[model samples]
Target chain A: MNTTGSTGLRPILERHESTLLANWITAQKAAPTYRPDLIKENELRDQCRDFLRALMQAVQSGSQNVDGSEWQPVRDLLASISRSRGKQGFSTTATATFIFSLKEPLFQLLQQEYANDPKVLAEQTWATSVLLDRLGLYVTEVYQQTRDSLIQRQQEEMLELSTPVVKLWEGVLALPLIGTLDSARSQTIMENLLQKIVESGSETAIIDITGVPTMDTLTAQHLLKTVAAARLMGADCIISGIRPQIAQTIVHLGVDLSGVTTKASMADAFILALKRTGFAITRPTAGR
Target chain B: MERIPIIRMSKFLLVSIQVDMHDRLALALQEDLTAKINETNARGVLIDISSLELVDSFIGRIIGTIASMARVLDAETVVVGMQPAVAITLVELGMSLPGVRTALTVERGMQILERAIGPTVTEGTDAGPEE
Candidate 1:
């Protein structure tokens, strides 16, 4: 009932809570970013209702500062919503629109409350805009954090997935490398290859690079470094799977791969490895 | 300075570095190994460094120096049992220890030595029939 402009938004929100909720839902439903496919209408309605209730409770403490402790529940609600939306594959615009869309219905309420006083209406509208903007930005921050963690987890998984050292025969180990070899990934590959070599006490290691798409000088250098490390560990390393283009690139770049024995395919490398390890495989006779 | 013992095996000299070597000790070992190789007329020298976890550029260079010195003395040197970390560190340090042979274990080192210089010669008293 106190319609004075000196009072903050709490009174206005309290007097027209239902009307504001209804109008806010209408505004959100009509928002361009609203995703009916991603979120059910009932679920969105529940989220809006809960957010409005938390906002009302927090504003009752007379603190317009969003960072104040009274706004803890509001922050928690927004963060949860943001994180959930992020996991649900909502775009940044769509997630941000959840908070920003409330501005339309809110400005209408402010206008009606200060119908005779344009100055008060303008002031309240600006304050509401700032408040909602801060909330929207907070939601984006949480959503970005979720996305970053998701990316970090995927990178770790990819690193684990890419490098696999297999023991093809006794005294022979095979390391099949896939994907682009960056410094970090090459470090991992070297460490993994060396560890397996030590564990198996293998005499020969075949490094198959068939899955590797391109062979730049850097990749070749990393390959040479790994071979050198393995050799220092008393394991002779052989590089295999030199596609014609990669071979031409190495020759064009004037990289010295003479020290490393290479084969055109992994099968040839495996046969040579078996020979070095003094193993012979003979095919079975036609019938047992 | 405590001298690293150079044990004379059949046709090879074996040096196992058990403790961390100081600069003086490494120098002493280097002199002792070369002298021992000369005195024994050994065909090969096997240095076991499995227990050595940490190696700096100095030790790496010393090993390289020993291998080169042995090669000059008409003897093959096989550095054996180098750990993976030591190998990576050596590679990173750009010391590949070229011209020196390497093996996974002392057994393999002996095999390499045997393959390079033939098997140990038997004394006249215990000569056995050839297979």
Candidate 2:
């Protein structure tokens, strides 16, 4: 609104100002029961827009005479805006605008004063790296927490899901898996299988996945890697219970599993493995 | 539980075959070739079946797939170092790798790949017969 001697770059500032007003109007219209008395949201759109315009003018002209102290007012305005909007409204668009508006001025100041200083450059780089690292850690922690909550809810829904391991002859373990084999579950399966193999001194592991819906290149590669890792520890991995659909998917995806021993079912895999180790299933037939 | 080794060279993808692959090697070959074609612009692929004792229809299908994929990607694909027993078994099963290049050794396969990539030096350029 202070239009004295603000000539060049006025159009760009006017555009941004209009956009902010439009966005604020839309936000207010969308609210179920808008409160007029909320001082935080009442003047935020105009205040922030004005502050940004002033900051841009100061940066463009390289005028240090124009008070840089106006930045605190802008920062305070953003803090209040963030508090009023809450986390859900903190979109990338808003963050990007704020960062871009500040970055130009910051870069200009640094270039003017510390351009020749290697120590200052190093310090700035180190500080930026630390900030980025902390941001990454925060994002990862948030994702893990959300995933854990979701998994807990799912577990509660599927109360009868069994985690049982069927023990075969001579320390061999047979795991019958059903449903989809995602990367996370595959990792868990590998960890559990390795631990069981070591603890039971089992030389062979039969993984029955007859109930698996389909297969892709990634899943096939994961299975191959698991088998290879098992061989490294002197144990052989047998994949069994492959459904017809999974076989078709493997062919479709063009993944090669030529070196893996596969069987029709857990029983077949178990018998074959046992026979190789000189053992037989001596139990009598029930219906005969 | 047989172990399969996957080794990658400059322009070749090598997969080592084992005993259990006897039943599915054909299909595996076809699939692997198809993937290689789709994933890379490499000139060739070599399947080393020296350790394999037998070959079957499944393996034959895989090899065919690889060849088909290679053709699509505008690259040449080859199967090399097939053991005598495995070759005989494949012949007995009435299976053949259609449109696929076959080589007797890994060295021969590399040569094929190099040739497919075109002459490394200019056709007319020479070192003047070692002076």
Candidate 3:
């Protein structure tokens, strides 16, 4: 208010907050992204009001940068709204319309206030457009960040869920691995298996690769590395679940698993592991 | 000029490496270990590497060389108590240490020796089978 060149957008918004909000809502509701199923009318009104109040405070401070401290509350509010809207299956365009719609009402007020001064009107209109564009882009950016984090978290969970080390007997542990054995997943598998072996003090570990999709050269190396590590830890490793195709792959690839024990099925591996651990399993001759 | 100590425990010479060995020291120790095997006419060798925290390819080859050398000299060699990190590094470095027998502890190594070479041959040794 002290400067003549100042836009005075703050006072104008404060005076006609309801009228501007009504107009903004009409613009949003008429758009193709108008989703009554996802967001209720009352909730939209509350968000509009909160954003208006924060923007008024921010503009009053005479700071041009959106990154300034005065705009923090507005940013926080929009980030939350963007994340929730993204989660609710709102399109990026729909979420952005929430910020862009306010420009209509805002431009009208600025035009009416600066009617006589063409220079002031043009300047205020350009400033409002720039500010609104930044805010709209911020919403989409926050939405994408939220989506990315959710995806990363799910990948980690999948890694942990896939590699589960189970105790087969008193001193024997078995790791039935599924899916492709990449470097990251191999690390998870190794760490989990090693920790389980230490905790159980198991002398024998059987790795069943039945669920593994294919046997590439890299995957074969990872398997051999796991076997060598387990041997170094004083636990001999046996690999099972060698399908005919996989067996052919290993032989065709000329992978040297010479000293290590491998079997065609989990049962064969289990029988061998039990015998090595000095356990005798007798089959029931008669059915109960 | 510090040297790694090689102690004779009955028929098996025990070398517990408690310090990080540089290239020269490791080569020197390899030479000393093979010499001790000949001097004592030991039947088995046990090298405990639990205290060894890091091992490059050079040190890995040395350990492999010593094991094969002992085997050629009519003695069995067992590397015991290798830390997990060192083992992983060795594998990743593409040195599998073939023909090297590994055990979790020195006690396990001794048991493996007795089982492999028979207790009868180790008749009067102080550290053989019994207490």
Candidate 4:
């Protein structure tokens, strides 16, 4: 160990790797960032041990500058750990603490190794803190990116799942729209409903908005666009589940519905659709 | 390019638009359709656009003009089989095509045309003689 000006962490880490790992894990569990409920002791211990090995390897390359290619292995290791924790629903702070927890144990080893030289101890500690901070930030960046992509994928899946087009009858189709009708979701709904209309050869489409929470101007325009598209495709669109409050809002907003047919419920719209298609439903009581 | 052929079926003119009509071709069809309506004395016109993938505002206006001209010539016009995407684009472009009638298919368009012209106009149907 070159103790004069060489402050690489390789010597201390190699000498007491197991002890330092155990201390680091103990300190980690004691911190609020650690969640034992999401992971087992053996798993966390394995990650910490692997991380220490990579850190020691990087330091052994004899490079004090963390930005150099020698420290790339350590960065790669931290990034992979952060990605795993990101998928496990770990918060950014918790994931960063995984790298930061090694600080205390490393500082302790440095203090003991350089007890006679306070200036070298302070210098080494400061360098370790700056390097650890950089590594912590890298982990957070990777974790945030993973989380954002995960959220966007889930949102797309939900949008596709929320809007479903059903074939009500031979000449009739139904679209049940649930949740807020943003422009993107509205585009999805329009495409889905129109595709169903074409496939089923249905002349009438009933749009059920019972699951929709509110009626805004944009949503109403989206509905009109869908209706108009259906009409152009040789299909008539009937909007159903217009609650009293929504009716008041539509009237207040002055959205035109002169060419559109609105019904209080899906059943009424279905009956009207059946009538338009020249089908009369007769319930025979004696047969039952 | 060949002009769109107008095939007369019973008392109606069937214009199955199998090609993507440019502005000139559409106008030529419009002129030919009205001229054929006057010569044949057709009661209805069924414009089948199932094969057409696009419809801009100019094409949309031509369709509307044809329908209005057919109405003035004492004929009903039903445009059928418009693709859903084309319809959405037309509506988005602020042309709902209020002047024309639409049906899901040519057969259904004939049914609507028969209904509009009255059931008696439908020749050789199951109910044409009975009703």
Best by DockQ: 4
Residue-level lDDT of model 2, residues A124-186, one tens digit each, is 434433423433333334444445666787864543342345668785788777667776676
| Interface RMSD score of candidate 1 | 0.8
**Cα lDDT of model 4 by residue, A190-252, tens digit:** 999888888888889999999899999999999998988888888889999999999999999
Q: What is the lDDT for A8 in model 3?
A: 56
Per-residue lDDT of B52-129 in model 1, one digit per residue for the tens?
898989999999999999999989999999899999899999988878899998889888887887655667663322
The predictions' CA RMSDs to the true structure, in order, are: 3.3, 21.5, 3.1, 3.8
What is candidate 1's CA lDDT for residue A201? 91
Sorted by TM-score (best first), the order is 1, 3, 4, 2
Model 4 ranges with Cα > 4 A deviation: A1-7, A36-43, A61-77, A115-127, A286-288, B119-131
lDDT by residue (tens digit), candidate 1, A91-120 = 998899899989888888888888998887
- Model 3's CAPRI class is medium
lDDT tens readout by residue for model 3, A142-200? 98888889899999899989999999997789999999999999977987886677567
lDDT of 2 at A271: 88
Worst 10 residues of 2 chain A by lDDT: A1-10
Candidate 4 chain A: 10-residue stretch with minimal lDDT: A1-10
Least accurate stretch of 10 residues (summed lDDT) in model 1 chain A? A1-10
Sort all candidates by DockQ, best to worst.
4, 1, 3, 2
DockQ of each: 0.75, 0.01, 0.54, 0.78
Give the CA lDDT, 0 to 100, for residue A227 in model 3.
Answer: 90
Q: What residue runs in model 3 are displaced by over 4 Å at the alpha carbon?
A: A1-8, A112-116, A195-200, A252-254, A283-288, B119-127
Clashes of each: 0, 16, 0, 0
